[model samples]
Target: MRIYLYLIAGITSALIGWNIGQFFLTDLGLFSSFPELILYPCIAISLAIGMVLNEIFISSPTRPKLCLKKAKFPVLIALGLGLIIGLFSGAIAQILFLPFFGIPAVIVRIVGWLLIGVAVGLAEGLTWRWETVEAGDKKRFLHRLIASIGGAMGASFLAAILFEVVRVFLQEMPKNLRLAEDPIGFSVLGLFLGLTFSLTSSPSYLVALRAGSGFEYVSQIFAQISPESINLSKDYPRIDQSVLTFVSDSSLDRIEEGLSIKLPSKGSFKIGSNNDCHIYIPSLPDHVATIEIKSREAILIPHVLYFNHIAINGEDLKTKKNIVLKHNYLVTFYSILKGENNSENTIIINHEKIFRFVYYNRFFDPQG
Candidate 1:
């Protein structure tokens, strides 16, 4: 069902983009001479639109951050292979059919459409295959190549049918209309090519794969934490503010006043007099404090701050403090003489984990 929906969305977006391109070309009076050229941009635009809509409406909850950085090499290779196959096939088709049909102009046009469709399909298919399928030996490469070629052929056939339909429609248009000329034919042809391109675009496949894999990872993490059972919505933290402050030894002068800080779900930050700390608090012992913020809560591990008369929420921190930070929290450091340090401490909250939990829970465990 999801696959069908994705296909429908892609086709619809391609048709819309095709009409838009045609309108532009007709309005600008550039449709007659360079009708085939419009297909390039139309196809690109349609594919982008389809992908974005699918990501936003169809598969947003499970979507993951695509590792585009790692996929660049495979994408480039796919593009190159697709171009080569398209050019070679197009050249052969033109050579074989031009003389047999004895219509140079028509043969050239058809060959161009075939080239665009096949090339776009193969490129997109290969890229998607690489991302969805695991990387393996040369056998996997052969399988991917075959699948990509088959997709390209299917796209080319569909494009051919669409081109004939549009061509027939244009032929039936009123003779007095300006669009009844070659512009109409070419515009329809461009639309056909665009549809073909959208049918095999890689964006939807990659997005869906990434999203599904991300959900699996999240589930694994949750399972590891608690095998019996866990309530993600209840356990996750919903932070409203995230701020951190640094206090110096001097009561009158603060080395650094206050700065907003952001923490990831699973990371640690250190603050001390040494340069190794994320925030340096001068006049305090080296590595005086450490903060570990997880998806559930934040832990403050005080080293020398325990004895330095550091106070959290008016309570002296004689030991480590496990703060259940909500909307707001404050931490202040004081000297032995009960004088407040110049550094300021503030808390910043993040609700990404909580939101993720709620979204998943709503869809996956509604009864729970």
Candidate 2:
């Protein structure tokens, strides 16, 4: 269901961007005098910008602080790969339509877009770190290559059919408009290619944080947290106000419908008192805990001075080792001397602040 939403959002944004670009280039005649050198870069950059925009608005919202930093690399990769792929695709199309080969122009055009789609997919795929075992690097490359080729080729064929339909429709119109060329086909091609890349590259598990007990007015879910230090303190400086703002819910409503903050797909996040931690809880000491998440599982490693201060699901983390996180696993960080569990199973920290968390795992099967 979420994947469907992602595809819808990605394709819609691509079509909008493509149409705006088309209006400028075709209708307004902007950059009409530019040579191939300038035009190719413009097209390539446009596609890159679209891709980055989709990721920033959609993917980065899951962890908003890292959005700016995430944009730089994917844009560069897409720009370089788009240019190289365009040249390669153009050369292939030219050869296919040559007198010797005698292939139809339409056939060659489809093939060209097919190749471009594959390259686009590969370019997006390369931006993420794929976790695998046994010949990981080679396997990852081949996986991206094959997935992109298949997905992109399918999209290109679909676009070709749609292009012909629109062409026929325009030819029959009262205005006698003719389909001179495909101005919008590439955009459709880009839309599906982006969707393909997202489907293949999305993480297996999504981790989110709900404001548990310590928070007063914060009942919303935080969808993204900074990878380095996630300060839970309401007064923490440097925190993005947008990230923390959400409609407050009643206590019962919060338990049923509260929003949560999503951590990055892979990172070591610190939860501490000061700004140095990845997550800061105002009442907790410096560096109280660290959450190391990778692939499908998250582990809670305590760093507090007292073992009794923190517990998972009412079990004290006495082994002093990493504890695997589970869904609805309550992790309470409180002062042993002053805190006590209430009727609702929530801990009241130091009689004033209560730092309690209920973990929820998304998309992955429950682990014992």
Candidate 3:
């Protein structure tokens, strides 16, 4: 299978979905008349792209050849995946946008359901579902997960580049806090964005890969690679059973020293405590975690590129660690995983609000 061809197909699918979605938005007068209204269609289209591309990969053996006969399956798969992607993404989007926009929640729910078709379609196109893998695959889940991480990192970097280019062209920066004008609303928005991204991108693919055939390899590797990412989230901490120990800034004074049991709120969760965000964020599994964060002031800092993980070029984890303490650094739990590249279980921290972190050229200070 030609990787580049797959990429091309993915891009083409996105464009097609976007155009179709754009029409829907235009007709509803959503962009201007009710900006929130368009979110579902726009995102559904994006998912449609993913679903279609994934479908193409599926059913095509030995380097996908140009055959229209086989193309229909992906479209069908896309329709199915799009239904899911659209509803879930749209629901998340609505939760986030409604409070800020003051639109009714029911409306957003309806919107989400409406776009499920597109979402299902996009998932088919974009996801790395194994059914789509070409013949003669050699790599196990571990390798595929690694490849996914690499791909996701690349895609994220490209997105950063594109966003920057667009920002420069428009003479403006992305919005961070106005969305915060309604914290509850913004939180919902973040959830939607996270769901959208998870469904439509590398996170989904990576999770699938890790969960598939090589689940053992994926699980073992994560177990061997931690202690650094222990408490990235207040509510959700990274868990690797193979490794008993955990890292945290806050002492585990509140819980019984040896007591480990089920969590009441979410069925079950391991208890560990920490104040430091750096170790937690990077330490957590790379494939499936949620990051609850927002930009501080929305300023584009120079020399700061957010890749698979955020890093200052030439600086080591040590420096990034220091940067975390001095400035809260908008920390949150993120599930980083090896990418067999087709799991849709990622949780994203979106539109994070970090008001205290200040930047000084190549350096950062937690104090705003």
Q: Best by lDDT, which number?
A: 2
What C-alpha lDDT values do all the predictions have?
0.43, 0.55, 0.34
Question: For residues 288-344, could you state the per-residue lDDT of candidate 1 as single tens digits?
Answer: 566676654566667643434344544555556454433233454432211344344
Q: How close is candidate 3 to the true structure, as a TM-score?
A: 0.31
lDDT for each residue of candidate 3 in 1-368, tens digit (9 for 90 to 100): 33344454444444454555557666655555443345444444454545344434433333455424445655555565554555465557556565678876544444443344334423442333333222112343344434433443344334333433443444443466333222222222223333333333331111000011101112335645873643223343223333221111122321121222111111111211233322122323333212211222112121122222332232322221223222212222223333455466753322221111111211110010
**Better model by TM-score, 2 or 3?**
2
Indicate the residue-level lDDT of 249 in model 1: 14
Ranking by TM-score: 2, 1, 3
- Best prediction by TM-score: 2
Model 2 residue 351 CA deviation (Å) reads 7.8
Candidate 2 lDDT over residue span 1-368, tens digit each = 54555565545544554565566666888754432223333444455455544544454345545555656777677777767876577567666767998887777767666665655565555554321121134654567557655775676677666766676676776553453334455556555656665666544336755556655443224414443334343453121232222112212222212344446668777776676665555556656788888886889888746445677876666766778898678887764223343544453335234466767665221110
lDDT of 3 at 333: 24
Off by over 4 Å in 1: 16-20, 23-32, 44-61, 64-106, 173-368
